[model samples]
Target: MDPLVLGGIVAISTILVLFSGVSVGLGLLIVSTGFLLVFDGLRSLELLPEILFGKLDNFALLSIPMFIIMGASIASTRAGADLYEALERWLTRVPGGLVISNLGACALFAAMSGSSPATCAAIGKMGIPEMRKRGYPDGVAAGSIAAGGTLGILIPPSVTMIVYGIATETSIGRLFLAGVFPGLLLVSLFMAWSLYSTWKYGDRALLASTTYTWKQKFEILPRVLPFLAIIVGVLYAMYGGIATPSETAAVGALLCLLIAMIIYKLWNPKDLWLVLRDSTKESVMILFIIAAAGVFSYMLSSLYITQSIAEWIATLDVNRWVLMGAVNVFLLIAGFFLPPVAVILMAAPILLPIITTAGFDPIWFAVILTINMEIGLISPPVGLNLYVINGIAPDISLKTILKGSLPFVACMVIAILLLCVFPGIATWLPDAVMGQAL
Candidate 1:
C-alpha cells in the first residue's frame, strides 16, 4: 500500500479510537500494532520489545517521575493551601484581587509542579471557595484558575518542556531557562486581564477588598518560604553546573518530601502512601503514552510519512512567517482536542524539520509551541484544564468555566504574538545564561 494511504488509515483509526474513549496509550499502541501487522506481517511483532526499551532508555526521562513526585508531595501537604492563602493576603488590595491572587498562586505552583492539571487542582480547591464566599462570578473565578493553570507547562521545570527537549534533542536545561521569561509574561497578561475585567465588568458587590497588617503579611511568609527555597535551589544547581536536570529533579523531589514530613507536619503514613500511589500512577501513564508514541513515530518515519510531509512543506511558496503562523494555528486547533505532550509527540517530529529549515531558532520555536499548547489546556470541549477546574468546582458548570477561560485564552494569544514579534522574550535569558542558544 502507498504510505500516504496507510498514513490516512492510521490517523483516522487513531482518532476514532481516541474519541471512543480508549486511553491514549492503548489507542496509539493498538493503531501502531495494526499498521505493523499490515505492513510487515508477523515478523514486526518481535521489534516491539526493543522499540519500547529504546524509547524508555533516556536518562532525562527519569526526571518526569521525580518532578511528578515533587509536585504530588506539595499537593499532599498544606503547602498548596498556604501558598494560595499567602498570595491572597498580599494581592487582596488589587482590583480583581482574588483572581489575581489565584493567578499568582498558579504561577508559583507551576514553577514548582510542571503539570497544568495539578496546578489547576491545587489553586482551584482553595481559590474557588474563597471566590464563592466573596460573591465573585463563577465564570471569572473558574476561568482564572483554568487559564492560569496553563503556566504549569510554560514555566520552568515544565514536564512538557522536558518531553519536548527529549523528543527534539534540545537542551532540557536551556529549555527550562527559556521558559522563565515567557512564563512571567503570561502571568502578567493574565493578571492584567483579571484587573481589567474586574474593573470593567465585575460585580462591585462581590469585589470586597481586605487589609492586612504588616505583621500579618510577614506571618504568611513562612508558609511559602520553603517552597521558594526549593525552586531557587533547583534552578541554581542546574544553571551553576552542580547538577543535571534529572539530578536537580531528584533533589527537588527529596526536598519536597522532607518539607512535607518535617516542616508542614503533614506526612502521615497514609498521606505518604497516597502521594506515592498517585505519583506512580501519573508517572506510569505518561511513560506509557511516551512508549506508544515512540512506536507510532517510528512507524511514520519508516513509512516516510514524516519526510514526505516535510518535503511537501518545504516546497510551499509561502514566506516562513506565514508558515509559522499556520503551524501555530494547527497546533492551537490540535490543542483543543489533545494534551500538550500528545501534541508535541505527534507534531514535533513532522514540524520541527520544516521549522528549522525555515531558519527559526529551535529554542524560540519550542517556547512558541509551548504557549500555543498552553492555550489548548483551557480551550473548549476537550481542554484538560477546563475539565480539571470543573471537577474541582462541580457547581461551576463547564460552560461557565469555558466562558471564564476565554479572556485568559486571549491573553495567551497576545503572549504568543509578542513572542513571535520579539523572539528575544523567550530566547534572551537562555542565551545570556548558556552563552548560546540551546
Candidate 2:
C-alpha cells in the first residue's frame, strides 16, 4: 500500500482504538505495534525497546513530573480555597466581583497547578457555592470557573506547553515566556464577560457583602502571597537563565511542598501520601503517553509516511494565512477529542515544520495552539473542565455548563484572531527576555 494510504489507515485505527476506551498510551502502543507487525514484520518490533528507552531517557522530561508534583502538593491542600478567599476579599468591593474573583483564582491557581481539571475543581468547589449565594445563576456560577480553569495550560509551568516545547525542540524557556501575555489577555477577556454577565443576570439583592474591613482583607494576603511569589519565582527562574527547565521545576516543586506544609499544615503522613500518590499517578500517565507517542512517531518515520505527508503539504500552493486557518481548524477539532498534551505530542511534530517553513514563528504558533486547547477543555464530548464543574455542582447540567462556556470559547476565538493579526502577544516576551532564538 502507498505510505500515505497506510498512514491514513493508521490514523483512523488509532482513533477507533482510543474511542473504544483504551487508555491513550496503551492505545498508541497497540496501534503502532499492530500496524508495524502486519506491514513491516518482526524487524520493527526489534526497535521497540530502543524506542521506549530513547523516549524515556530525556532529562528535560523530568520537569513534567516535578511540575505535576508542584501542582499536586498545592492542590491536595487548602491552597485553592485560601487563594479564592483572598481574591474575593480584595475584589468584592466592585460590582459582580465574585465572578471576577473566581476567574482570577482560576488563573492564579492555573499558574500554580498547571492542570485545568484541578484548577476547575479547586476554585469551583468554593467559588461556585459562593456565587450561588450571591444569587448568580447556575450557568454564570459554573461558567466562570469552567472557562477560567482553561487558563492552566496557557499560563507558565503549563504541562501542555512543556510537552510542545520538548516535542518540537523549541525552547522551553521561550515557550514559557511566550505564554505570559496571551494568558493574561485571555484572563482579561474572561473577566470582562464575567462582569457583563453577572450584572445582567445576577441578583442585586444577594450581592456579596462589601463591608469587610481593611484588616480582614490584609490578613488573608499572608496566606496567598507566598504561592503568588512561587509563581513569579518559577517564571523568573526559567526566563532569567538562573536554572534550566528541569532545575527550575525541581526547585519550584520543593517550594510548593514546603509552602503547602507550612501554611496549610499539610504535614500529616496521610496528606503527604495523598500528594505523592496523586502526582505520581498523573506524572506517570503523562510520561507514558509521551513514550507511546515516540513509538508511534518512529513507525511513521520508518515507513516514510511522515515524509510523504510533508511533501504533500509542501506541494500545496495556498497562502500561509490560509494554511494557518486550516491548521487551526484541525487543531480545534483534534483538541475536542484529545487532551492538550496528547494533541501536542501527536500533531506538533507534523505541524511545527509546516508552520516555520511558511514564515511563521513556532513560538507564536505555540500560543495559538494552547488557546485552542483551552477551547477544548470546555467543549462537548470530552470537555474535561465542563465535567469537573458538573461534578462540583451536580445541579448544573452539562448543557448549562456548555452554555456558560460558549462566551469564553468566543473569547478564546477572539484571542486567536488577535494573535493572527499581531503575533507579538506570543513572541515578544520570549524574544525580549531570551535575545531571540536563532
Candidate 3:
C-alpha cells in the first residue's frame, strides 16, 4: 500500500471523526489506534507508552497548566470587567471608542490569560452589553468581542504557542518573542477597522454613551494595574532570560490568583475550586492531545508518509510564495474544525520541515499559523469564540456575530500577507531579544 494513500485516508478519517463531534484528543487517539492495528499489527502497540510518556515528561510543559491556572483565575473574577471599564473610561471620548476599547482590553487581557475563549467570555460579558446599550450595531459589538478574543492564542504565554514550540522543538521563549509584534499588528489592524467603522457611520455617533471624570478613570486603574503589571513581568521574565517559561508561569499564576482573590474578594473556596478545576481540566486535555499527537506523528513517520510528503512538496516547481499560500489555505480550513492547540500539535510536526526546506524561518511560520487559527476562532460552522460571544450576548444571532467578525478576519489575512512580504514583523523582535532562533 502506498504510504501517501494511507496518509490521505488517515487525514480524512480524523476530520470525519471530529465532525461527528468527537473531541480532538480522543478523535486523534481513535484514528491512531485504528491505523496502528490495521497497518502495523498489534505488536506496534509496544511503542505507545514510550512515545506518550516521553512526550509529556518535559519541564517546559509545566507552564501550560500554570498559564491555564493564571487565565482561569483571572476569568473567574472581575478583572475582565475592570480591564474593559478602565480602558473604556480612558477611550470614551473618541468616536467608536467603546468598541476600540474592547479590542484594546482583549489585547491586554490576552497577554495575561492566553486563552481565546476566556478572553472572549470575560470581556464580552461587560463589553457586549455596554456596546449594545449604547446603540452600537449588535453584529459589530458582538463581532468585535469575538474577534478581539482570538488574540489570546497569538499573544505571549499562549497555550497554542507553547504547544507549537513543544511539537516543533522550537524555543518557547523565542516563539513568545516572535508572537509579540504580530499580536500587536493584529490589534492595530482590528482597531483601524473599528475606527473606520465609526467614521463610516459618523453621523450615527459610535462613541460610548457613558462618561467618566479624570478621578473616576484614575480610580479604576488601581484595580487593573496589578494585572497589567503581571503581563509586563511575565514578558520581562521570559525575554530577559530572567526565568524559565515554567518559573514565570508558576509565579505569575500564583500572583494572579492571589491578586484576584484579594481585590475581588473571591478567595472563597468555591471560586478557588472553580479556577483549579477548570485549569486542571484544560491542561489535561492539552497534555493528552500532545501525547496522542506524538503517537500519530510516529505512525506517519514509521509509514514514511511525512518524509514522502515533504519530498513531494520539495519537488514542486511552484514559487515558495505559492506554496505558502496553499499551506495557509489548508491551515485555515483545519482551524475551522480543530482548536489551535490541537492544530499545532497535529500539524506542526508535519509542516515544519517543509517550511524550513523552503527557506522560511520556523518562527515566522509559527506566527502565520497562529494567525490562521485566530481566524478559525471566528469562522462559522465551528468557531469557538463565535459561540463564546453568543453565550454572553444570547440575543445576538450567530450570523450577526459572524458578520461583525468578518472585517477582523480580513485584518488577520492582511497581517499574514504583511508577514509574508516582511517576515521581520514576526522575526525581528525574537532575533533582537533572543539573538536569532537556531
Candidate 4:
C-alpha cells in the first residue's frame, strides 16, 4: 500500500475511534497499531516501545505532574475561592463588576493552573454563584467564566505551551515568558468587553457599594495571597536564573502544599492522599495522550505525510499575512470539532514546517494557535470549557451562554489581529529574556 494511503487510513481511524467516544489515548493507540499492521506488517511492533518510552521519559515532563498536583491541592484546599472572593470585593464597585471580577479571577487562576478546564472549574465553582447573586445574567456569568478560563493556556507555565515547546524544540522557559504579555492583553480585552456589555445593558450589572473597610479588605488577603505569592516567586526566580522551569515547578508545588497545610488547614493526611491520587490520574491521562500523539507523529514522519503536506502548503503563492489568515481560519474551524490536545497533535506536524519555510515566527504562531484554541473553549458541541461551565451553572441555557460569549470571542479575534500586526508582542519577551541569559 502507498504510505500516503496508510497515513490517511491512520488519521481517519483515529478520528473515528474518537468520534465513537473512545478515550483519545486508546483511540490513537488502536488506530496506530492497526496502521502498523497493514502498512508495515509486524515490523512496526518493534518500534512501539522505543517511541512510547522515549516520549514519556523526559525530565521536563515531570513538571506536568507537579503542576497538576499544585493545582489540585490548591483547589482542594479551597484557597482559590478566597482569591476569587477578594477580587470580587475589590472589583464589585465597577459596572459589570461581577463579570470583570470573573475575568480577573480567571486570569489569576490561569496564571497558577495553566489548564483551561481546571481554570474554568476553579473559577466557575466560585464565580458562578457570586455573579448570580449580584443580579448578573446566568448566561453572562457562565460565559464570562468559561471564556476567561481559556486564559490558562495563553498564560505562562501553560501545559499547552510546554507541549508545543517539546514538540517544536523551542525553549520551554522562553515560551512561558513569551506568553505573559499576550495573556495579559487577552485578560484586559475581555474585561473591556465585559464593561461594554454592562454599558449596553444600561449598567444593569452595576452593584451598589457595600462598604468593606480597608481593615476588612486587608484581612481577606491572608487567605489567598500565599498562592499568588508562590506563583509570582516561582516565575521571578525562573526569570532571575535562580531555578530551572522544572525546579521552579517542584518548588512551587511544595510551597503550595505547605501553604495549604498552614493557612487553609486542608492538607491533612486524607486530603494529601486525595490530592496525590487526583494528580496522578490527571497526569497519567495527559501523558498517555502525549505518548499516543508521539506515535501518531512518528507514523506521519515515517510515511512522509507531514513533508507532503508541508510541500503542498509551500506551493501556495500567497503572502505571509494571507497564509496566516488561512491558517487561523483552518485552526478555528478545526478547533470547534477537536479537543485541544488532539488539535495540536495533528495540526502542529502539518503546519510547523510550512510556517517556518514562509519565514514566519514559530513562537508567534504558537501563540496564535493557542488563541485559536481559546476560541474553541467556548465553541459548541465539544467545547470542554463550555461543558465544564455548564455543569457548574446548571440553570443557564446553552443559547444564552453562547450569546454571552460572543463579545469575548470578538475580543479574541481582535487580539489575534494585534498579534499578527505586532508579532514582537509574543516574541519580545522570549528574545529579551533568553538574550539576557546569553
lDDT of 4 by residue, 341-387 (tens): 77887678788898999988888888999999999889987788888
- Candidate models: Cα lDDT each: 0.87, 0.89, 0.89, 0.83
User: lDDT per residue, candidate 1, 1-438, as tens digits?
Assistant: 766676677778878987888888888888888878878788887988799778999999999999999989888777778899898888777768888888899999888888788889989999988887887788888999898888999888889999999889899988988999999999999988888878787646244666889888889898789988999999999999999999999999999999889888865799899999999999998888888889888878877888877888899999999999999999998888888888898778888999999999989999999998988888876899988988899988898889888888888889888998999998899889888753
RMSD of each candidate relative to the true structure: 1.7, 1.2, 1.2, 1.9
| CA error at residue 6 for candidate 2, angstroms | 1.6
Indicate the TM-score of model 2.
0.98
The segments of candidate 3 whose C-alpha lies over 4 angstroms from its true place after superposition are: 203-208
lDDT (Cα, tens digit) per residue for candidate 2, span 1-438: 898898899889989999999899999899989988998999889999899879989889999999999999989988999999988888886777888888889999999999999999999999998888777887888888999999999899889988988788888888988999999999999888877886787447234556678998899899989988988988787777798899999999999999989989988999999898988999899999999999988888888888888788889999989999999999999999998888898887678778888889998999999999989999989999999999999999999989988999999999999999988888988888888788
TM-score of each: 0.96, 0.98, 0.98, 0.95
How does model 1 fare in lDDT? Answer: 0.87
69: Cα error in model 1, Å: 0.5
**Least well predicted 10-residue stretch by lDDT in candidate 3:** 201-210
Q: Candidate 1 — which residues are off by over 4 angstroms?
A: 202-207
Clashing pairs in 1: none
Worst lDDT 10-window in candidate 2: 202-211
